[model samples]
Target: MLLTRTNPVIKPRTLTSIHEQLRDHGVNLFHTQMHEREAFKAMFSFGGTLETLDRAQVNNIDKAILNARDFASEVVDILKAAQNAEGEGAHLAATSAPMTSSKVA
Candidate 1:
C-alpha cells in the first residue's frame, strides 16, 4: 500500500502587507482611510454617545468609514482579478488545503 503525505505551509497575510499590496495596485487610500475609521471608532468608544458629537464630526466619521469600505472593496476586486489571472480557483485551492501526514507500520 502506498500512502500520500502532504505538507503545506501557509503564511497568514497581515493588514500592513495587504495595505502594501493595495498600494502597489494603485489603491493607495486604503491605509489612510482605514486609520481614519479606526480613529473615529476610538473616539466613539471613549466619548459618551454619538449624540454628543457635533454634526460635522459625525459626518466626517461616516464619510471616513464609507471611504474605507469602498477602498476595501476595490482591493478585493484587485486581488480576485490577480487570482483569476494566475489560475482559476487557485486561491480557493490554496486556502482550503490542509497539511497531511501518513504513517505505516
Candidate 2:
C-alpha cells in the first residue's frame, strides 16, 4: 500500500522510478488519492470519520471516497484471484459488501 509521503522531499522522478522497480518485481501497489492524507488528517483533527466530516470544509472529499471504494474493490479482486489460482475458489469464496464512508475510517 502506498500513502502520500511528502517529508524528506523526494523528487517525483525518483518516486516513479522506485514504483516502477517494485512493480517489475511483481509487487502489488495500492495508491490512495493524493489528498486522501489531508482528509484523514482532518478526520483526526475534527474527531470523526469521513462520513461525519463537513464536505464544505474538505476539498476533493468526494474523490477521496471514490478512491477508497476503488481501492477496496481492487483488494477484493486480488484476494478472489489468488483463491482461484490456488484452487480454493469453490470452497472459500471471497466477497465484500459495499462500504459506506462511515465504515472506512
Candidate 3:
C-alpha cells in the first residue's frame, strides 16, 4: 500500500522521491540492492511454462509468497518513513526557499 498508483503519476513521483531521499541520506547501497534483488526475483521466480507444477511445488511457491509478505511489510515500513520524511522536507523547503533566496540576493 505504500504505492498508491490510482493516479499514474504517483508511482514515478514516489520513486523519484525515494531516490532523492536516498541520495540526500548518502545511501546508494539500499537502492541498488533493492533493484538488483527485484530483478533477480523476477528472473528466477516466474514460471512461464504451461505444464502444471506438482502439489509440493505449488505448496512451496505458496509458502515462498507467504514468507515474502513479511518482507513486503518491512519494505512498506521503510517506504512510509521515507515518504513521511520527504513530505516534511518539502514543506520545510517551500517555507525556507523564499527567505533564503532573498538573503542570498
Candidate 4:
C-alpha cells in the first residue's frame, strides 16, 4: 500500500524532489543507515560478516552494523503487528459465521 524504502542510493540532489513527490501521493519513505553504505558492500566483497570485516579498510563499519541491527528490529515489529491483525481478523470471521443444518434419513 505504501513505499517505505528505496534502492541502493537515490542520490543526494534528487532525494528531496523524489521524497516530496512520494509524500504528495500519501507514500512515506524510511531512510536508514543500512540502506546505502559502503561498509555493507565491503563485507560481501571481502567475504566476511560485519564483525569479521577489517575496520581499517571499511569506513563507518561500526555504524553500519548498528544500523543493520536497528533495521532488523524494525522489521520484527512490523511482522508482529501484521500477525496480530491477521489473528483478530480470523477471530471476527469465526464469530460472525451463521449456523447451518442438514436433514438425514
Candidate 5:
C-alpha cells in the first residue's frame, strides 16, 4: 500500500485512510514521531530499522506524515477562524456561539 502526502487539502475519507495506515502507529504524529510514542511506537510491527520497510511504503508514510502535518495546518486555520468569529469588540473574549451561520454576510 502506498500513501502520498503531496496534496495539502483533504477529504474526511483521506483522514480515515491515513488512520488505516497507522496500523499500530496510532492516529497521527502525536503518537508516531519517536520510538515510544504512547499510541504508535509500541504497536509498530516492523522489526528493524526504517530501512527494512519497502522504499515505497516508507515514502508513502512520509507522504502520510505530510498529510497529517497539513491536517494540523488546517486545524490551526479552523481554530483561528472560529476564534475570530467569536470575537466582537476589543474587550470581549471569544465566546462559543449558540449557533453559527453558514454564510457570513
Candidate 6:
C-alpha cells in the first residue's frame, strides 16, 4: 500500500501564517499539538527506526500522517475558495463599471 505523504515544500513561516488565517476565519484546523511530538521524532530519526518502534509509537506516527493529510486538504480548499472569490470580485467590478468611448470628429 502506498501511503500519501504531505508535501514538505511549505516553509514553517508559511504554515504558521496559514494556521493563523484559518483561525481568524473561524475555521479550526491543523492542531499540531496532537501530533507534534511524533512528527518531531519522525523528522530526526533514521530511515530504519520505524522497525524498532513500539505499537504506540507507530500509532502516533499514523495519527500524525492522518492529521497532516487533513491539514493539507483543508489548506487546498481554503486557497481554492479564496481564488474563486477574487475572480468573482474582479468580474463584478468589471461589469459594474460604466463604459466610455472617446471620439474625435
**Reference-based lDDT, each prediction:** 0.52, 0.66, 0.49, 0.72, 0.47, 0.59
* Model 4 lDDT, full chain set: 0.72
Q: Tens digit of lDDT per residue, candidate 3, span 1-105?
A: 232222322346767787678678876433212221222243356543213334444434443443446556777778899999999999998988765344653
lDDT digits (tens) for residues 1-105 of candidate 2? 554543323457877788789889998677542333566578788878777789888766666666667767877888888878777654444444454476754
Query: For model 6, what is the C-alpha lDDT against the true structure?
Result: 0.59
Of candidate 2, the 10-residue stretch with the lowest lDDT total is: 2-11
- lDDT measured at residue 51 in model 5 versus the true structure, 0 to 100: 32
Per-candidate clashes, comma-separated: 0, 0, 0, 0, 2, 0
Q: Output the lDDT of residue 42, model 1.
A: 47
Task: Write the residue-wise lDDT of candidate 4 on 1-105 in tens digits.
Answer: 223333444546576687688779987445443456677888779988988888889888887787788877877877899999999999999999897677786
TM-score of each model, paired residue for residue: 0.34, 0.61, 0.39, 0.72, 0.33, 0.52
lDDT of model number 5 = 0.47
- Judging by lDDT, tell me the better candidate of 3 and 5: 3
lDDT, candidate 3, residue 89? 100
- Tell me the TM-score of model 1: 0.34
Report clash pairs, candidate 5: 5-63, 25-40
**Which sections of candidate 4 miss by over 4 Å?**
1-14, 31-35, 102-105
Error of 3 at 90 (Å): 0.9
The digit string of per-residue lDDT tens for model 6 on 1-105 reads 112233444447765686677788887554433334455365556344433556554456556556657666767887899999999999999999999988887
Q: What is the C-alpha RMSD of each candidate to the true structure, in Å?
A: 16.8, 14.7, 14.5, 4.1, 14.5, 10.4
Winning candidate number (TM-score): 4
Residue 91 local lDDT, model 6 = 100
